[model samples]
Target chain A: MRIFGLRKNTMQEELKHNGLYSRSRQALLLLACFLLITFLASFCLGRYGVPLDELIKIILSKLFPIEQSWTSQMETVVFNIRLPRILMACLVGCCLSVAGVSYQGVFQNPMAAPDILGASSGAAFGAALAILNSASNRMITVSAFIFSLITVCIVYFIGQRAPGHRVVNLILAGIMVSSLFSAGTSYIKLVADPTNQLPEITYWLMGSLSGTRMSSIGFVIIPMLLGLIPLFLLRWQLNVLTLGDDEARTMGINTNLLRFVIIICSTLITAASVSVSGMIGWVGLVIPHLCRKIVGGNYKYLMPATIIVGATFLLIVDNFSRNLMATEIPIGILTAFIGAPFFIYLITRKEKML
Target chain B: MSLTTQNLSFSYGIHPVLSGLNFSVEPGQLVSVLGPNGVGKSTLFRCMLGLLSGYSGRIMLNGLEISSFSVRELAHRIAYIPQSHGQSFNYTVFDMVLMGTTHQFTPFASPKKRQIDAAQMALEQLGIESLSKKSFCCISGGEQQLVLIARALAQQASIFLMDEPTANLDYGNQSRVLDCVKQLSQNGYTILLSTHNPQHALFYSDTILALHGGTIAAFGVPDDVMDESLIRLLYGMEVEFMDAGKTRLIVPAQGRGDLCFVGSHR
Candidate 1:
């Protein structure tokens, strides 16, 4: 009987090993190479007709001191517009996806997204209120930052104090607070000065990379990168946290402290993303799950894959929004247009719910 | 070598789960906790491992208060295998077991070579070394239980607190797990485990504790707590204790005479 059991276990083990090897490592390598290629392609393909050779030459010139008569238009297209937009997309995408991944692990729910817990709504309300009160642009960002922090604090209190402290209750509280704040935002929009601030508010809510300037890039990049620093440093603790709160505590981790730090970090990441990009949707939610399906769930693997995939995904979404039609669709609309269908495909194609 | 409790009590909201529960164990002794389902067996283990808070209790391990030790220090002293875990989403078996060595690692440090070897040894001890690469959720329930127990063993703690380690196993696996528990005890690890199976308690434990209504009902030798009246009180049913040569068994009083006669004839 023991011999039979051993033989059966070995056969089962071999089959599982084959499946894991075939699916995980190759998918990871392919996704990594695909992200790199997409980033380079996004850099090269644009309205200014920079051929791949000139693009590579321009890139090499920038890196090394190669002499070439690069036109002012080419320089402006490459360095000023395309580079900043791509960099912003990469930063915001990476930030949002990392936040999404952390939140999913912390909450242990696959449906969790970056904005699901009122972070984006809270930031939007802050930005809108800033517009209402004639606050400076920088101060508008600060308002968004502070209010997003407040939203999470309120949600945490409500969820933690509920009867069972259930994950569903937390999610419900997030939706409740989110809708409430969004309604408040609508009210602000209703009463704003239509001639001056209305277009600003409308465009801000629509989310765009059209206004991608180097200064604006620095504004969001600095804080978002700072917010991501802690996550990178404590990445392993994040993995341990996925084992659930009780198990994490039993493993000699102070689960509450780690969770509090994570909430602050991811909130900062999310708030910074919204403060700059004005609420790009679905990249955070979809990118991490896509990466997880491809690379398995170890955060050591999941984190880097998420960064690269998020960058590539947003770049692609931006490309579609830019050239797919005569009029530029807002990046948010394109994200939703592409994201919902792709997410549906993922859900349908998935054999098991993670 | 000794763990002693002084007037330990725990409550949730207003209702107490364990009140004034006192017990002690020395090195190399296997202790069994027998109680009905909701009699605070799991809670008691949680408290002993310092997982639950808001409890007024004094649990001392080797002359030190349990609460005084850091979580890592406490984990080094007492390892636990919980009865149930919420399903993991495709975490590799090796990663699941490697988590046990988190206490040994320097917070963010990855598992060292020695720790990996230790985890491998623990899996081998449970006869599941081949499961190291399998997704944890894809394995059978019994195999999962073995992996968890193997993880607890990898902790290398001096004391083991197991909450129903054999609760979900089939008879063959149950016997194997119990034999492992016995072997651990013989190697001078003090073990206190809660179980629903009286036979496991009888066959493996050197000390038996029976709890009822948040208090200790019977405590001492297997011969003392394994009596019909105490077992009936603990389980709230009539049970007949019978001895056949060196083996002991408990059966319901009224219906199972045929099986008993067959065993007697055998």
Candidate 2:
């Protein structure tokens, strides 16, 4: 008589777990190629179109000495215009998705988005306040980032002291604090000049990468890397965190410390992403979910997969936002348009809840 | 090879849960702790695992205090097998088992070849390697319990802290899990398992420790320490002892003649 259970081994299982790795690895490679293609193609698909050959020469000129076959107009658009925007789209996309996935794991809640801890709302209020005060663009970004961190700090402090399950309390605190900052933003919008500051605040609130310059990348890359690298390294702990707090602690994980670090890093990434690009939605929430569908839930695969898919997805969406109409569509609108429907499809198509 | 807690007392906001609790578990013994819900069984386990660090008194492993050891050092000695996890991710059984080796990894390092082999060996030891490729959420309750135990085995720890390992299983699965647990002690692993069922302790435990009212109710060899009064004290229920060939059973005393079979059971 069988004491435990039946054993019928699959051939893939016989491959000593490399099969899972290989499939995810192959998919990641394909997605990386796709992301690269999207990156290059975004450089070529603007209103003042740079042809593929011209785009290639423009990129190669940076590496090796080449004759200036491209016109000054094309050079200005590529170097000062499209390049920064493309890089910003990719960086913001990657950061948001990574932060989103990290928050989901840390909180053990699939519904935990990048801004679930009030970072975006804080950044929004900061930007609106800055625009009202007539602060320069750089100071606006800095203010947004600072207030974003400060908002999450307040939420975390309150959440820690709230009398219930920590995760639930944190989420509840996030909702309340988010509304508080959003109300602050509404008040700032109420008093600002409608023609200039009000429109600027409104447009920024809707999210755009339109004015991203080379300097913008320099501002964000440091904090983004600071946040992203630790998250990438701590992907293993992210998996343990998903098992809940007690089990993770028993597995020798310093759960509270690990969680604090994860929260701080995720907040850094989210705050930086929002500070520059306004509040771009859906890429963070949807890209990770899509990656989970492609690769299984193991963070080892999911983290890298989300990075590639998120960057590619945002690049493609940003391209459409620019080229779709004479007036550039705010990326926030496009992402919600694309992201909400796709998220619904994912939820409905699968028997499992993501 | 020994775990001893001396005058270990814990409280939540001044309402004490476990007070002056003292017990020592021997090496390679399957010691079952019988206790009712909210009688501080879980709180006691938390204190022992070092999750609740605000507790008073000392818990020592072998000879040293548990608090002195690093998290990794403690994990290398004592493995915790939770009843089940609240996993929303579709991690495979192999991935679930692989997490057992997290304690061995240095900071920023993922599991390597040595850890992978350990996880594989753990599944093989439990004879559940076939389930390695299956999603953890898709497995049966019994199979999930075995997988959790396999994870503990992968930790390579001598002591296992299991709180109600069979509390959620079917009758057949419960025995199967107990049989697997019993075999672990035979193989020289110290196990401290908590249960609501008294018979499980009588049949499988080397020693039974019953907790009630913030203290040790009784602690000794299961057969010698257990009686009708003790059962009543622990569970607040009436039970009669039925003598078997070698062991005995605790059956609920009195009849249900006042009530019908179909009344508001659930």
Candidate 3:
């Protein structure tokens, strides 16, 4: 019996040794290359159209005092405008994707996303309110960030107090809170001046990167890093969390504490992303699924892969948003358009690996 | 390691599940907990693993109170095998088994090379190394149960608490799992498993603990505790024992007037 088992084992061992790591490595390399290409394309394919060689020269000149061969307007577009927007796109993408992955694991639900905790609706309400009051751009961003955090906290507290399964309760609580804030947003929109505030409210709710500035980068960077770093460090624990609360507890994890930490971290990154990017959807919901298709479900590989793939995916989508139409389409619209169909395809596929 | 529970009792608001239960298992013993449905066998196992609290009892592991042990310490000493169920994510068999080594890993660190080797060794011990690369959700039910056992083995704990380990298996698979449990016991690993089948207790376990009406109805060696009277009382069915060569077979008893012959007259 042992001999027969061992004979079969040799075949499996051969496949295991050859199949897993090599495939994962190849996927990682491919994603990295795609990210690089997308980043360069986003920089060069914009309206002003900086050439690839000049783009490289400008980036190099920043570190060292190279000859200023490019025009100063080109310099402003590269450093002051396009560079920050590109970087912010990458950051927001990474943030939402990581948060989505974490939420899915914690809830053990495939449909879970970062906005499940009412963050987007709450942030939209805050942005709408600020727009109604004629607040400054910075004030609007801050209000949105603060309100999103508040909404998540309320959902979490209500969920904890509710009976039945924790995941179900949290989801139900989220729906309630989300609807409340969404109503609040609608009320604000109804009261605002239709000629002035209506279009601005509509634009922010639709989501875009037009308002991304170098000044706002500092505000988002600190919180995004603060949230992302802890999540990356705690990736292994998140794997255990996916096993359900009772199983994780048996394995010596403090499930409640780990869950609390994960929620806070994921919330911080999500709120930061929404404040800057204004309710962009689909990247959070779809990118992790796409990454799982590439790297499999082990969070050790899945988390980093989600980060890279998400950044690349959003940058490509943002490019299309700006360049596809004469007027800039909202980033959120493009993501939903791309994300919804791909998600349908994933579900309809027979393999159903997830 | 020895496990002893003294006066363990638990209730859910107005309804009591386990009441004043006292039991102990010696090292290297295979003990079967026999009970009807909803007799709190799983709850008792949970209490043993410190997964459930608010039970008034002293649970001692090798003479130390279980309450004194931290979650990590308890995890190192006792491993739990929950009933196998489908997962939302389809983790590979190796990844599933690697989770047993979580207690050994420091916070913020992934499983190292040594841990992976241990997980591999566990699969090999269970003769399941060939299934290491397969997706867990796609595997057969028996294979899934074995993977769960392999995961417990990877924890390297001396005591194992399993809840209905073979509840969903066919007869052949059930025997295979019982054989594994028997082998583990011979290798000096203490095990306590809950089951509805008294025959499994008769054939495999050294000690049978029969629970009824929120307490232990019988506790002794299988021969002492598993008589026709106890079987009838526990399951509400009359039974008779027949000798077949050297082994005893249990069969349900029929009423005297119900017998009839339909074959041709001889």
Candidate 4:
């Protein structure tokens, strides 16, 4: 039966009449375009510069075998070093941003981020331990990912034990767990060899995509996709989740189960991102807020918007990180330098909403 | 769906909240639960919604035990509207209303086109379609309450349990909400709302359920159940009923020398 068709048409008509709807649609399109432009620009503007035209031709030549005019060195730089790094930046950005948005919704706290459950700190410690033992790069990534998940699981169990106010309990438990892991990370650094192992550990903790390889990208991509698909599909349920536990439960949602699933998925994404790219912070926390300004806080649109915006944001920041100096600055340092001020501006301008 | 509770009792550890509360609501009836603060009004509503377990009694929805129904089944039959409060996010009114359709879709599925249409129709039913694009946080308290009601409407449930729906609203908003409640009852929706104001119960409700000291102090038609003595017993304050043409107004009774007129020189 066509019972709901009439109302659907009317709703569409009303939505078209409303300017915000079209504006948001345009904003999403603009973000998608921005992401593409930034991605290509990131590939072309690295230290070993490949012109935009050459970059495009190289990309197209992969699909269609055209005679290469550029030197093989240029091709190697474009394909081997810059491409994987750019892709890793995009993947890590996408992962952290989606995880942040989910954490905020699940906690019903705008200030929440992926690190709230000590995932990053725990991952850092794991990477440090692996480096201390002279493990392979892949082993370090694996250990980091596993430790991040374990840390969040520990925080969740601790939070569940507290009596009242589940959200508050979880936040408090997260802080305690985070501090505990942070101390462990500090201890690992203190005992490592001063010249080599210490510097490596410190650099990893600072977070970078300097040594990213195609192999490491494969490790992250599967877990990231596995985590993101559920979040994207269940964005509507995430909205109900933000309404608080009691209301969501009454709305026929299994709040505890949904919360557990969201936590696990978000932790997987965050852990994978941190393992591949080290400890990039603020992307998860700030990207979602920026997207909220664009998309008006509906997770249905906000989730996908966060993915695009975050990927684009980190790509732009990474471009600056590499090109702004002779020595490549850590992307984490650049993000914090940029993210904190931008966040301050957002807060001061929209104080009432905050 | 009709709702009935027989010999319902609930306690929190050593403290009892509701005890031996018996009440039945027919379809298309507007019942107002009246009590002072901490009188188990909200507790009773939670019990009815199956939010609180370990309560001993037989609470039935359409002759089916409430405990037998899953959370989703209960949601299909009954919707709960807690007191309106600020949200952590500034969701659009349309998005806020769309949340009511959560129960209709699977956990991994987004709300489809039909559910969106249901939310829009709900907004139209409440006569707030123009506010669809506005931020829910930006709206007035009254408008927010109406949006919440629209959300409940979108749920397509037969029974509504509201806990102090108009508690924080201004006088005009309170009247508007009460009017909406009356209209819903007239349209064959069973509604049970709790309030501290007995006048709302007097003017709007078909039946009054007065809870006092963890028990049902009074229950019946409003006219038969509400009286000066009952108000005194419920709130520990003496009151006088004044005739207002066809309706009655409640006023606090004055003790000796309690009523004094102060003149302004200006």
True contacts kept of each: 0.32, 0.54, 0.60, 0.70
lDDT of 3 by residue, A1-354 (tens): 998986676666555555655777788888989899889878897789899999999989979999988999988998888888898889999999999999998898777999999989989988999999999999999999999999999999999999888888999999999999999999999999999999999999888998588899998899899999999999988888899988888887888899999999999999999998997998888998988888888898889899999998888888888789899999999999998998899789888566
Q: Report how closely model 1 matches the true complex, as a DockQ value.
A: 0.26
List the candidate numbers ranked by DockQ, top first: 4, 3, 2, 1
Candidate 4, chain B, TM-score (2 decimals) = 0.95
Clashes of each: 0, 0, 0, 0
**Candidate 1: C-alpha RMSD after superposition:** 5.9
The prediction achieving the highest lDDT against the true structure is 2
Off by over 4 Å in 3: A1-19, B256-266
Cα lDDT for residue A106, candidate 4:
94
TM-score for chain B of each model, two decimals: 0.91, 0.95, 0.94, 0.95
- DockQ of candidates 1 onward, in order? 0.26, 0.47, 0.49, 0.62
Indicate which candidate wins on DockQ. Answer: 4
Between the candidate structures 2 and 3, which one is better when assessed by DockQ? 3
| Residues B1-266, model 4: lDDT tens digits | 78999999999999999999888999999999999899898889888898898899889988889989888778888898878889989888988888988899888888776777788888889899899889888999999999999999988899999988988999999999999989999999999999989999999999999999999899999989899989989988788999999889998888834433455343
User: Candidate 3 lDDT (Cα, whole model)?
Assistant: 0.88
Q: For model 3, how many clashes? A: 0
lDDT of 2 by residue, B1-266 (tens): 89999999999997999999888998999999888889998898888888888999999999799999887788888989999754777888998999999999875889887777788879989999899888899889999999999999989889999989987799999999999999999999999999989999999999999999999999999889999999889877778999998889889888855544567665
- Structural similarity to truth (TM-score) of each candidate: 0.90, 0.94, 0.95, 0.95
The whole-model lDDT of each prediction reads 0.81, 0.90, 0.88, 0.89
